[model samples]
Target chain A: MTDRTPDDLYDALRDRLADYGQEPPAPLWAKIRAQLPPPVAAPQLRRRRRRPIVLLGLLLTVLSAAGWQLWLVSRSGPAVMPAPQTVALGSNAPTNAAVASPASAGPSASPKLGKAALENPGMSGASISETKSSPSTATTDNLRLATQVRPDSAASRRSGPYRPQPAGSVAGPFAGGSQARNPRLAVLSRSARVRYSAGQPSLAVGSTDSSVELPTAAAFSTSGSEQGRLPVDVVVAPSAGGHKAVERSTAPVFGPVAASATDYAPGAPASLLASRPVAVLSPALPQPRVQLRTDTFSTAPAVVRRWTVQVLAGPTLTHQHLGAEPASDPSLPTGIITYLDSIVNEFSRRERMSTGYSAQVQVRRVLTGRWSLSTGLGYQEYASQTTYVASTSTSTPPILSSGVFDMAPPSPHRSTYRFLTVPIRFGYALGQSGGRLRYGLLAGIDAALYLGGNSAGKEAVPTAWSISGSPYRPLSASVSLGLDFRYRLASHLEVLAQPTATYFLNSLPRPLSGLTPHHLFGAGALLGLSYEFR
Target chain B: MPPPIAPVDEALLAACRRGESAAQYQLYQRLAYRLLGVCLRYCPNRAEAEDALQNTFVKIFTRLDQYRGQGPFEAWARRIAVTTALHAVEQHRLRHPTPGTDPDDLAADLPSAEPSALESLAAEDLLALLNTLPPGYRTVLNLYAVEGYSHQEIAELLGIAEGTSKSQLARARRLLESRLATQHYQQLP
Candidate 1:
């Protein structure tokens, strides 16, 4: 056979050099030994030991905070104000007059007047009696009522704006025994344990309220002395037993009212005043002209209006599917085509889904009851491991020289993709707002910026390496749905667990040889804490 | 023909697996010369080959648990040496300007040595001839001929087209044959 044949020449060359060997420098082993990694079990053991302690610590902290918040809510009293007592209407009484029953004019007035009387308005006489035994009164209580005084009284005759004084000093002619026989008029004096002061055409009466204090509801101001005053009128209700009334017109109870013949009527049948069991009436004054303004404050439950901040982190499982066909470059040799097909097959075979992690901090705004909107910055990492196996057996169209050659063993290569994400989500809460346990649903879109990533294995195969630049759109987006579970640890703090599923809207394509792109899907349950501001 | 390979000592491998420093050192001493020879075939210089040898041994020790005693340990170790050497060559080519474009420029990067006289030479030093070739041609030749890789395997290993690997190997063989003929003719007297 001619030795000029390529195979013959190569075989001769391989046979001669097959037993080749050479000594390396003495320092080589020490260099390799220096790069050795520490044992793997230690770090894993430490991580395992740390988990339960952290969970227990978190539980203890939540319990302590919940107890503290409950204590605080109880000590702070009710967060809402009570309703005002409704003034019973009398037939002959002026519409603008604010009159009280003589039975309540005593110093033993019930602090539970507003609630009990309003609850049983038809049997208010019995309700007031039942409520009078209640000692649960507001620590700081004061009720103010505005009334008009008659111009003929010395209190109203003063020029300019009349300076107010103690209720006793301005009692006028109704100060002494006249106050006792007609307790309705006495309700405005010092004997009733009330503070009353009068200005031109206006009186300010302050009394201890056993229940609610409505200062703004009972205040009035007159601009000048030109504003005329109407005579103060008293309408007393009959007792529960139909007790005879002490006639106010029997004496000069009110100077202006007693002097007017038309206004004063002694022994007038109380029946003409009202059809109810008890009625207190005031003679209708011409142009009594009192501007009565009842400023009502809302009693609705207070809403949590603070901005909530949530920090979340979790382990994420990512699934990636890459689809590609070999490059159809027919101009290349048949061997190259075969090689490209092998590469695609190898890549598909080696790729595997793996777990990664994601973390984020979010600020949420409660737009209305049970509805919220949140946006935050987050980071997500996805990893895929590809294993490349080496072969030792000789292939067809074998080596020019017949000999065994070394090949690298099978190795696992991990390719990671990192993204800086911005998520905007809307949430709807389920169940009561202040309850300790609550559930919610969330839906949103997350936009991501492709942060650079690195591969953890052999770089020999370009298709197995981390992908970037072309084919990988620098920007990507995904739609996610989540079930959010929240446990309120305190008034302002809560623990949150959200199980989420996200599907990427865009694809990250493999470089070279790979034509079709791959989409990523992720599922994770994130645990976090949310704190609301006071 | 297959190269000569020593048998693996199971007891020594077990000790190395247990992270014994003495056993690791003994394993390194036993295998260093052969793996270094394997490294020299692909790397451009002895120093780079030595560096490749160091990396090869590091990989072998760290991944020793993965070795399942299928073939002789030497064959497995030699394979690691070849991969490490190829990685070094690839890194060197990337750092420099495109040396593959001009074969003469690529050959100039290697050290020049005199050919041994015929008859006096016990065996033809195929390695010296390989050193005279350019990096691309020499790598293709080493993988396809000496390493027994198919054109498709060579393409995947070197990240090149199979046609390119085939053509490069042909050129490398022609150069080697002509040089060998010249050496024989000069030593004919």
Candidate 2:
């Protein structure tokens, strides 16, 4: 072993120092005892503070998405039509004529079918009771008249624009109690109503309805004053007892009906009709033809209109600034603009408000005339914040009822809720329903249920952490109030925007007892599109 | 004189934990010198080692609840003393810029009093040889050989890499070997 190995040398050296121990200098333990600290819950020297980052992230995403949607909602298309709808025909100055018996005249497919009856020219003015003939001869001659006249030739006579007679100017169809005497001719007038047609005219019944459907519905709304039944001259079927004299307007429903067979003029652009509500008339019944002088295009036929079903979807948003209330106009004007500015500034802070979002589908049912009832289902999300303050002062202060945020501690307690909502709204129409610009007022309440949420107490800082009880209510129900403004983009499409405010009925408590109770008031807007199933 | 009384370390520890001042003193006196050696091997000088020794005793008394009593009390006390000594060295470095701590600097500035007097000396006397080495090399050697620590564990404690710990230990061993080869096992000066 002339050459010692490295490991052997290292072991020999380590063996020498293994049991080493020596005396420390004097007064050592005394120096150490002086530096001791008070006992702590845990020996961890550092604690971490995390901001409400998830809340802020959710808020940012909602705001960005809502802003983009709002931009899209603001976009609109031009659907203007130049064809004069509801254009009156003929030289006859419109008279305030009461409507004639629409049931008294049956539309004769053969022009010659009525020619034999009209052989006596004065019969146009004669009443049914005045016409007396042997019943067997009257029935046989009417049947022969129906067979002998050519239906194809009658189409040639429909070669002119229709003239609208003043419905009030014409004699009432129910005049002389004729309908009472003949059970088949009875028709009733109820609430004020208006009817809309694409190229066809829709008639809203009487005062029972406040909203009127105008002919040439969407882009060309007839003035509300123009709403009423077609000026008298519609055809009605006489009693099967014996053929009677009938009052008929010479105006053809459409000159183009026979030429195009599709009824409306073929040359007219379909896009113009798209902007207005299209009235689908049963092909069996033609419009009550009006006799008018030289006009280029045909007008809508007057017939009782049907109820319209409107569906709309769109994006909407609303925000009530943090620490804000619904603004009320001042009873008296104040001269100080700066004071007004200061008040606005106080309510305009963003930090005080919590924003939420929702997606909704609505179906509006137009009722009698001007009033409609609306209801829809929506998924809504909203958030609110409350704060708890640590009181350093020994003496207690009175708790505030309005909001406890002012005197509370530095820590903020936040609560969030997701809700499914059902809203019942009532609307009153201000103008004709088919017009380019229609105005209305909507008042509604949304019944909602809480889906899920975070409680403020769970996030309270250590200084404010004093939870002996739960700070949240069960997730059952909540309610909101809103006002929606509607605008129509097309016959089937409308845009609705509602500024809404939500109130959580239950009061939430902060982590620390005796802190101000937490109440959440969230305000935002909901936007949606409406589609009508006419 | 009569044979030295046996150390009733367990009973002394139990009494010391009950706040008996006399028992605490007895326990401290019994173990202080041994722990002082551990601190001194890590510390750059005796004053710092003495301060570390004092801190270790204070912590042991204040945190006696931490002891599970699975191992001997001396080993537990020895660990605390070593850690305290290492902490003192780190604190010194942070407060004052460190001077050169390589073996070359040790040889050039601190002249050896008796360099060849280690191999034949008793194991208890080997502390003088450790003190002659650079601080980094001496700490690595002390932790690895005496405390039975792995290079990775020594690296973590000293805040260096495992390779650096191994190299430091090797250098300290080489310096000791060279010194040992130059002398015979002679009695202390």
Candidate 3:
């Protein structure tokens, strides 16, 4: 009997086999209890979720917002990163040659270190503080670092007359790579000790007093190749002891990059990029070598202790439970639930996705290198849809039939929610310290106060099916996660794009169920620009 | 032929149709275990089958207005229960169906054996055998052999071509018989 084939067993036992396992439908009952609304009190579980609209219109509007002053900066390239805080200048103000010649940054030596190189004969102190490749350094220590005459003593001791080097000039042992090179290094004879009797600050092109003047190209003689014409300017200024500021330069004064715009106009000598490494001719020391500090002016503002502000606006997505106002008849099975569900599902289709826009203006404080805390006030609007079904009879009759055709309900309709949000986020900026394009990440929690929102349900006509107005709650809490991409158009102006997601902890709409909360959350791709307030 | 509706059940059904909580509960208790067994053979596990059972009862009560004293209420209820299980299977959303390489050819290649050993099989063994078939194969076999639905009816019911139903039933039978033969040979040794 035990060895019989499947045919014999089934032929004998077909339909006779009772409940094989005594397993009651316990979990099934639980799901029904959880999902189905009670006969008297319907479950308010929200099945609707938010979907983000492609919203190309919004994106184009933000991008072309000519009148909206995001104060856009243009950075299709990388900014030069600020160097390390290896050298401190103390109280002695040092002139920055890097402002004049970006590629000429020498070893990061303090003013004292540079001066020591100037006084000592046999000393070859090439203290080149390696330039940081990252353009996003917001540290205080790096801000405290100051520029010096030249990078190190190697330039002071190297035995070569000052001559203009081409842009590709090898950055000897002081540094490497094809950086902007000043050919006229004016390499001092090893024995020279350059110092100012009146503490005349070392002169560089950009650091020159506004009163400093340059000579016409005809007045100056070019000593290098046509591309790199070195203008022979012998400048003499009244030392600090004399309050009067005067320029005696027949020579061309130029901040290589800035000079092109200001000092060296269209007809001005184009040789600044190729000009001699301009040293401060103390009018006493024959050779005073100056190295440019390429770190942007904003790089070392760590001492400025400034708090910044930015604005973020993007399309966010989330879901909320909508409309628990039932139109069910107690006559149907499960009464109101069955009737209401049928009317909503079979007649008027309800939308499950919530689409919204989030715009926040945030105030950020740099807590440390690349780390900042930002808190912002923002406004968000979320929209969802439902249809209304009404009876054809005169008075507002309860749902009377299981027949979907009983009332011809209007097509789908929409519901909107607006919230005033206060969000606090912790952010980390990644990329070059002073680079044009910056990338970062931020995470935060928010307490979103629901500003009074309007609920427009489809207007009900007697005998017609229409959707009821979805109710709203006053407040909701949520968490946000996002990635930020930024472009620095100017020293103080930056355009930013942050794509983010916000998850809510409580439901936005009061659905029929008391225990179940229809929490809504959203995602937004925020694109806005920030201006440094300080 | 299906059995007639009992008078006591008829009274209970009427009460349930009217959404009487106690009567609905009574109806669920009496038929739930039996319906659950039918749901179980088609589902991957007990929990899913229970879900199918719950949906079946909900459907039964909601569509009670249309149930017109046709055949027997249990038979109609069991039909709903069976189809609900198939619907649950469809909801699983199986992906990447291969290009059908002629179901007829596949059915032809499979080894066949008389499932005579079914006489010795307990309900658990039968369920075990049923579970071994793929979802489509199990569904087709359950409808055709157990539920007595023809291939054409099964095709219309499942939204498949009639040929697909016949082939799936054949493959299901082949797989079950092979397994039965192996079990029978093992027991004999």
Candidate 4:
């Protein structure tokens, strides 16, 4: 044999071993198959099933809220009438303002101007001219109250300004109860508009600081009275009995004057009971009227776009796979890779779901009526426990030699992974937009970039095994689905609860050699506060 | 020499990604022979080499998703086999260290083998000579000489100093020379 240089030897080894081949043992296949985990269900296939269920649930929530709003609209009815009360009119002089006596007539009546020889110009049923009777001098300057009360007729229920009846068609106010005996006298003035609600007369007027209820026979029919500085005479004729003196007292009644108990005779007509409290005023009030118009009470619906910023934090449940290296002895029943696994049952232990947490700041903008787009940045952390059985022997032995184990091994317990997340989400609000409480469905893509990580355990000795290097991809993305529930706590602040589910679009790289790669599935609920810009 | 291993089919890899059992088996069948050759170069014996082969396949099937299609699938699989075999060698050394022949303290004074002796040896003879060396020497030799790895890369892979990798490779060559000399003399007798 001739001598060879070190370079020649290396070259020879390289050239000769380049085409090396060996027959694998027959049992190798069986061993490998036994060791492999069950076939993984394709993420896409599972994802397809998951997406529809969430969409269906979101649709149902939206539909249910819409249906409820419709039901409420359909069940609406007219304005409710108020209870009856007696009212008294006060004046400085003894005037000949006679009350209209309607036995079967409703509250509405035609206002006829009487050729009054008295100071007051005109009088009508349920019409109180505050300008003439008001005790205050300031109110006398700009205030004018010429009102006409109408009965509940088809024409009266029609919503509009009051219209005057034809002149000389009926008896005037000076005609007393003679002309108003016919219940068809539904007359009103043309300058102001008023509607009676809940017994308090709703008065609309221009530049008027105060309003008083109409003085009606129905108001005086209830038997109650109060002391007053001014004296006034009120006479009510019962529809059944002949004209009985309702109040013929000379007593000074400055406040409300009610009918005496004798006026409520057993045979008295209850025609006023069918009457809703009526207070009508002329529509021709001054320009820029502060008076309430019942026809203008219904407002048009408006669309509002909102922008919000939110901060969210919550606990998370993470599902991942931390597979172990193949066991040195493949014949071992459990197929554990080492004593570390032998002690921990790492196969099942690593498969257990772990708990984690995350916090994020988000900005959401309403794109239009019910759709919104959201983007946010966040930090997330997940911790998994791994047991490492380290050898405590200090003697560094030669190659292919066993170590001297003088003491028991220490097991390191936990490995933690942290990520920073950027997410872009599209949202569809589930319920009515104008309500204090609302729900929405969100679908998004969340990109998670791996941050730093560390392992924690009792390190009694420098073991051969340790957690080092980047086992996970630097960047990964996930499909995120969430249900967002929010309640408005103030004009610009809201409380939020968002339950989320995330499926990683790709798998996490293995942390240890011979371990399987795994995808991460996470579910969490985030409670947060949102501030909206008006 | 055995027929060159065929390049892995893309459809087979896609099917494997979908977790098809038949595709996994087919992939295993295609790569097993070549990977076993890699394992044998690092391992001390056939049983241990087969163990490494089993580990290599398990890793391949489980982590096949990591393959980004940047290179040939066969090359990726071969890299896995090499790493697995190296890990096996490390584990064996830790469990059963040779007392006097520390890999770091290997003899540098041994005579180099004759070039004519190496030229006369077949690939099988070369592999047999490689098996006689210590695990550390075998590892360094396989990585540096046969696998075309640099000293720095071998050092990183084996968790040793770069200088140590060079010394180990030098010692492994001298040991191979000594073994070939003994075999040639025994044949002369």
Candidate closest to the true structure, highest lDDT:
4
Fnat of each prediction, in sequence: 0.30, 0.31, 0.16, 0.47
TM-score, each model?
0.39, 0.29, 0.31, 0.48
DockQ of each: 0.16, 0.13, 0.07, 0.33
lDDT values for all models: 0.49, 0.41, 0.46, 0.50
Rank all candidate structures by their lDDT, best first, as comma-separated numbers: 4, 1, 3, 2
Candidate 1 chain A: 10-residue stretch with minimal lDDT: A125-134
Given candidate 2, what's the lDDT at residue B57?
Answer: 79
Instruction: Write one digit per residue (lDDT tens) for candidate 4, span A1-534.
Output: 022235777787777786587778787898888877656678864775466456545644564455445433432323321212112221211122222222211122211211111112122222222221222221211221122212112122112221111222111111122111222222222212222222433232321221222333344333243211111222222112111111211111111221221122222223331121111121222111112111111111111225689999999887665434432334322321343233223322434466788888998866555667677799877655444433322221111112322223335444556788877777889878799999999898777777856432111122222122343556677789999999999988999998998877766553332334456677999889999875
Candidate 1 lDDT score relative to the true structure: 0.49
- lDDT by residue (tens digit), candidate 2, A158-219: 12111211222121111111111222221111111212233333321111111222233222
Give the TM-score of chain A, superposed on the true chain A, for all candidates in the order listed: 0.42, 0.33, 0.39, 0.36
Residue A251 lDDT (model 3) = 19
Give the top-scoring candidate (DockQ).
Answer: 4
For B1-189, candidate 1 gives per-residue lDDT tens digits of: 223355878899877765678888888878887778777888888988888788778667755754557687877787777767876776565566462366544333333223232223444256776687787788887766666667877765655666888788877766665666665666668
Query: Residues A168-244, candidate 1, lDDT per residue (tens digit)?
Result: 22222111111122344312211111111232222212222222211111221121111211123332332222222
Give a tens-digit lDDT track for model 3, residues A1-534.
Answer: 122234443454356443343456466655543443343312221212211112323433443353122211111112321211011110011111111111222122233233323233222222222122111231223312422323332233222322222333221111111111221221222212212122333322312111112222221222122212212221211111211111111112222212212122233221432222222222222222223222212123342444677987878665564334444333333523343354433333344566778888987766555666677799987766545434332212222321223443345545456778877777788877677888889887776666754332211221211122223445567788999888988888889898888777666544431212345667779999887765
Rank order (by TM-score, best first): 4, 1, 3, 2
Clashes of each: 5, 65, 64, 34
Q: Model 1 off-target regions past 4 Å?
A: A1-306, A323-345, A387-409, A456-471, A510-516, B1-189
